[model samples]
Target: MGMTLVRSLFLIIHQKMSTSSSAILTPVGVRGMNVLDRAKFLRNIKIPVLKVADEKLSKITPICKQYFLKLENFKPVQSVSGEKLKCIHMNPEKIGAWTDLSEIDRKSLKEHSVNEDNFIMKDIELSYENWSYGTIFKAVLPENEDIVSGFTQVGHIIHLNLKDHLLQYRPLIGQVLVNKIKSCRTVVNKSSTIDNTYRNFNMEVIAGEENFLVTVKENLCNFTFDFSKVYWNSRLGQEHERILNFLKPGDVLFDVFCGVGPFAIPAVKKKCKVYANDLNPDSFKWLNHNAKTNKLNMALFKSYNLDGKDFILTVFKEYITNYCLGKEKLEKGAKIHVTMNLPAIAVEFLKCYKGLIEDEELLEKFDCEIIVYVYCFAAGTDVLAVAKSMVIDNIGCDISDNIIDIFDVRNVSPKKEMIRVGFKLGKEVIFSAKDCVSEPPKKKLCVDN
Candidate 1:
C-alpha cells in the first residue's frame, strides 16, 4: 500500500507462498523399507519476479534479463500466481524488496510501464536435485553430525561403510543414492568388520536390486563372483596391474590365498602357468569358474582349496615334479613367482618357504630363480623398515641382502599400510638356511584333470 497496488501485490504473494507445492517429491522403494519423504528435504524460498503481460514480454525481457534467477536446470520464465501469467524471475541476490531497487533501476523498468505490481513473489522450491550431493545430503542431516560422504562401486553395486551415528538413516541414504546415481542398481552397507579368516564381511542390502553376484573387468579380463561370499577390493585394481607388469610368457605364478583369481586368471592369459588357491571354499569355487570363463587352459591355470602354507608347498611340490625332476635343467628363461596376498598375516606363511625343499642334489638341478611377494599390514613412522623387520622375524632368515624391493601399495587406515615385501628366495631359504621342517607336509599335490 506504501507504493500503490504494486507494493500490495508482494504482500499478497507472501500470504499464499507457503501453500505452493511446486514439484513432485519422487519416492523410491525396496523390499523392507518405506519410500523416502523427499518433501521433508526440500527447503522453501520465495524470490521476487517481474510480471510481464503476454504482449509486453518480448519488449521487457531483454532489458531485465540480467536480474533473472540463475539456478541450474531452473527455467527463469515461469507462472507462479496460480494464474498463467508468464513472468521473469528476479534474483534474490540482486534485490529482496521494492525498496531494494536503485533509483536508476526504478526509472529503467518504469520506461516500459513495469512497476511494483509487476514486482510479485515467486515461490522457489529446492530439493536434492538443486545442488551437489554433499550439499543436499548435509542439508537433510542434522548440523554437526557426521555426513555419509562416499561409497565404493563394485559392478552395479554401491558399497557404503556407514558409521554408528549414521546407521539409523541407512535406508534413506540408500534410497537417495539409488535415485541419484545412474549406474547404481543396488546399495549395500557393510554390516560388520571383515571376517579375518575369509576376508569377506557381512552386509545388508539397503535399496534397489538384491543381487550380490557381480562381474568386474580389470586388466582387460572379466571376473565374476558372489561379492557377498568372497572378498574383492576394486580399489586394488592398480595393485593387480602392478603385479601383472612383472610377469612374462611361460613364467610360473603361485597365488597363495588368492580370492577368486584377480591375479591368477590374467597371469595365465599371459602364458604363465598359474597355481591359484584360496582357503575359503566359496572363493575356490569362483576361482575355478572365472579361470574357465576367461577360457584359460585348464592345464595352465591350476586351482586349489588349501590354507596359505599348504598351498605354497603344494605349488613348489608340483613345480619340482613337473619342471625339475625329469627335466635335465629348469626352463631357461622362466621364473617362479609366489604371491601371498593375505595382508592380515601373510608374512608368517614365509615359514613354509624356509627349508621348503632339502634334497641338495635336486635343488642344484633347478636353475630358475624363485621370487616371493608377501603382502602385510604394518604401521610406524618408518613403514618400510617396520615391514622389513616383520618379514625377517617370520621368514626366520637373514634376507636383507637377497631382498629385491619393498613397495608401498596403499593405506588401509590411518598409520596402517598394505606393503609388499618382495625378495629372491635363495637356495639357502628353500634348502634349510634356517632350522625349519626338513620334509614337505604329506598332502595331495597334483595336476588335476
Candidate 2:
C-alpha cells in the first residue's frame, strides 16, 4: 500500500511537470525502490512556489533563513495546491539592495534613515544653497524668491528694501539674513523712499537690535554716525577710494556735501587739507567726531554746517584767497578739488563756481587749477547729454567736451542714473567778468538747520 501511494504521487508530479520544469522534478521510478530510498528521492525534489504580499514577507523575512521566493519558481495556477514545501528559491539581488544585511543591522538602518532626514546621507557637505531664503521659504512664499539677494549691509546692520508682497514676511526674512551673516546683529527694512535733502529714509527694525547708530570702516578710516539722521552709503566705498587715489600731500579738498566725512576724513588721513561741509547738522556733527576718531588734526580738517552755496561763498572763498595771496606761492603740483555729492541738486551748485574767485589778480597769482567733481541724477536714454547740459546751463559757460569726464556712478532706479561729471574749472570760467551770476538758478532750495 505504501508503494502504491508513492507511485501515485510520482505519476501526478510527472503529469504536471513541463519541459521548463523538468530540471526541478525528480525521475519517476520510485515505485520499485525501498521505503528509505523513496523518502530520499522526495527530499531532493524541487517544487514551484509563489510570492506572498510584500508586507507579509517583510515581517517573516528577517527571522527566516530562506524565506525568499524566486521569479522562476512561480507559475500560473487555477487553484491552490495542498502540497507543503519546505524550501524556497531566491532570485538575484536587486539594485541598491544590501545582500549582506542581517537581523543585527536594524540599528544601522534606523541611523541611515535619520541621517537622510538631516541631509547628511553622503560624504559631501551641504552648502548655502541648501539653506538660502529661496530654498527655505520657496513653498510658503514664492514671490519673494529674489529678495534675499538684494540686501545691503551697513556695518552690523542689514538693510532691505522689500516690496509690498514681501512686507508680510519681513520679520522672518530678516531673521534668516541675521542668522546667515555672521557679523550682522540688526536688520532694517526701508519704509519709504529717500526724498529728503539729507538723503535719509524711514526704516523699521525687523530683527535683532533697535539702535540705528553704526560705525563703518572705509578706505582704512572708521566713521560713526546715526544712520537715521545722516546719509551713508556702503556702496559708495569704491567711489570714495577712487577720489582718494587722485589726492596728493598738501592738496586741498572742498566737500560741499560731505556726509559723515566719508571723503573728507579719508582725505585728511592721506595728508590732504579738507574743508568738509554739509547742510545737515547731524552730518556735520558726526563729521567732526569721525575726524577726531581718525586722528586727523582739527586745524587741517574743517567742518561746517552751512548750505552748499553759503559754504562756497564764505569758508571756501576765504581759503582760496588766503592760499593765493599767502607768502608761500601756490605749488605747481598742488590741486584744489571741490566735491558736490548731493546728486539731486549738486549740479545746481555749479553756478556758484562762476566767478568764485572774482579778483583776477588773486586768481592769476595761483598756478594750480580748481577741479570740480559734481554729481547729478540723469534720466532718459541720453544721460551723458543731459548731465553735460546741466553743468553748462548752471555754470553759464560753454565747456569743451575734452575737459569734462562723465562717470556713471550707479543706477538709482529703472529710469534714473547717478552720474559724476568731473571737469577742470578754467581760468576764464572762474574769473571771467562776463555773464557772472552771483546766485544759482532758481530751484527747490535746501536750507541748513
Candidate 3:
C-alpha cells in the first residue's frame, strides 16, 4: 500500500506518462501476492486533503495547486459536512500540520476561512486495478526484464511478440490489453518468426475474440483483410506516406509485394497509375476489394497475383516496352517507382531486373528516371553498408552511383534491422546478373480479376 500509493502519486505529480513507463520495473508488485494473478493488484491508501467551501473552491485551488493529487478525471469538489466543498489534495512532504505549512499556504488557508481544523486524510485506492495496460504490465513484470508494451494494431486486433521471459504471463498481458483498449477486441501472439513465403506467422489468440478478419484505415484508404493470412505492419504507416509523398500526380507505382495495397491504392487516389502484385491470393483479392472500397480509378490501378519475381519481370518489361513503343505512357515530370517491401528476401528479387529490358535504349529517349526501392533486413553495426553489399552481390553489379538513398527503416530485433535501399534503375546494372540464373518461365500472364 505504501509503495504503491507513493510511486503512483509521485509519477502522477511529476507527469511521467506511459512513454517512460515501459523502461521502468516494479519494485513493488504487491506484498506476498502472486504477480500473475490480476486480482492481487489492488492497494488502498490515504492522503490529506484540505477542505474549502464551495464559494472559495475556485479561488483557493490556484493558490495551493502544487499539493493536489493531479489525477486524470479526478473531481476534487464533493458534498461534505451537509454542504458542497472542494477537496485540495496534500501530502506529508508538502504540508502536514498548521505549523509546517508554507507561508503562502498559510495565507491561502486564512483567506479562505480554512485551517488545520479542516485538514483531513482521505482514503485513496492506489492499485493496478485502475491502471492502464501499460502501467499494469510494467508493475507486474519482473525487475530488469525489458517490457513488451509495443504492439502492432491492425483493426481491432492487437499483435504482440512476447520475449521468452514474458511468455509466462501472456494470458494476463493479453486479457489486460483487450480489457483496457476499447477498439481492441482480439489479442494474439506471434508463435513463430515470419519465415513463411507470405510473411505472416502462426499465431495464437491469447485473449478476446478469435476472429482474424478486420477492417482498418490508413493514409485515407480503407483496408480490410484477414490478419492471420497476410502481412501488414502498422509501424510502416509513415514509411508508406514517405514513399507516396515522393511521387507526382502522373507517376507510376509498381508494388511487387503489394499485400492488400497499402502503397497501391493511395497512389491511385494520388492520381498515380499503380501496377500492384502479390503471390498470396488472399492479398490479391483484398487488393482488388480495397481499391473498390476506396472507390478508386480501377483503370488507373491494375493488380496481378503472381510470384514476386514473375510480377516484377512482367511489369518491368511492359513498363519499358510501352515507353519504347508509345503503347502505354508516362507523363513528363512523372517518375517510375518500384517498391519491393519484403524486407527478408526482397533484395534477392532485385535480380528480376537483370538483363530485364534487352533494350533500355528508350531510357535515354525519356526525361524520367526509374527508381527501385528494395527493402531487406541487415544485421551489422553499419546497416547501410550491409544493405548495399547485399544489393550489389545479388544484382552482380555495383550500383553505388545509382543509390538514391539508403534508409534505416526500422529495427527488427536487437541487432537486425529493416533497411530500404532506393536507387536509380539505369541501364548499366540492368544488362546482367552473374549470381542470378533463375529466369521467369514462359507462361500466360497472371492477372487478378
Best by TM-score: 3
Which pairs, if any, clash in model 2?
none
Please provide, for model 2 over 1-449, each residue's C-alpha lDDT reduced to its tens digit, 9 standing for 90 to 100. Answer: 11232233223221211222233222233222211121222223232232223334334335333434232124212122453322223222311123333445434434333111211111111223223332333322432134332256777787767766567777666776576556778989874466666667678898889988889777888889988888877667778888899889888899988989888998998888888998888898899998888899777788888888898878877877787788434455888888988887787778776777878788667566778899888988899888988888888888865245888887666678888898898767667664645566333244211
lDDT of 1 at 43: 62
| Comparison by lDDT, 2 against 3, better one | 3
Q: Between 1 and 3, whose lDDT is larger?
A: 3
Give the residue spans of candidate 2 off by over 4 A.
Answer: 1-130, 144-150, 327-329, 360-363, 434-449
State the displacement of the C-alpha of residue 185, model 3, in Å, after optimal TM-score superposition. 1.4
Question: Which lDDT tens digits does candidate 3 get at residues 1-449?
Answer: 11232233234222222333222222144322223465565555466778778888777777777765543335445557666766776644455556667787777678778877888878766555456555665556554555553355777887777778778777777787777767779999885466566666678898999999998778888899999988777778889999999988999999988999989999999999999998888899888999998999888988999988777667767777777677877786778999988776777777677777666466565445789999888887898999999997777677899998999987776768889999998767664433435643223222110
lDDT order of candidates, best first? 3, 1, 2
lDDT of each: 0.72, 0.64, 0.73
Q: Considering TM-score, which of the candidate structures 1 and 2 is the better prediction for this target?
A: 1
* Candidate 1 deviant stretches above 4 angstroms: 1-35, 46-123, 145-150, 328-331, 433-449
C-alpha positional error of residue 33 in candidate 3 after TM-score superposition, expressed in Å: 7.0
Per-residue alpha-carbon lDDT of candidate 1 for residues 1-449, written as tens digits (9 for 90 to 100):
01132232223222211211222222112112334675555566778888877777787777778777765457788764677567787778677887677787777778888888788776767665654334344434434554542246777787777767668777777887787766678999974457446777778899999999889888888889898888887768889999999999878898987899989999999988888888888999999999889998888877888877676677666675445577523356878888988777777677777766767777766556878899888889999999999888888878999889999998776668889999998777777754743343223221100
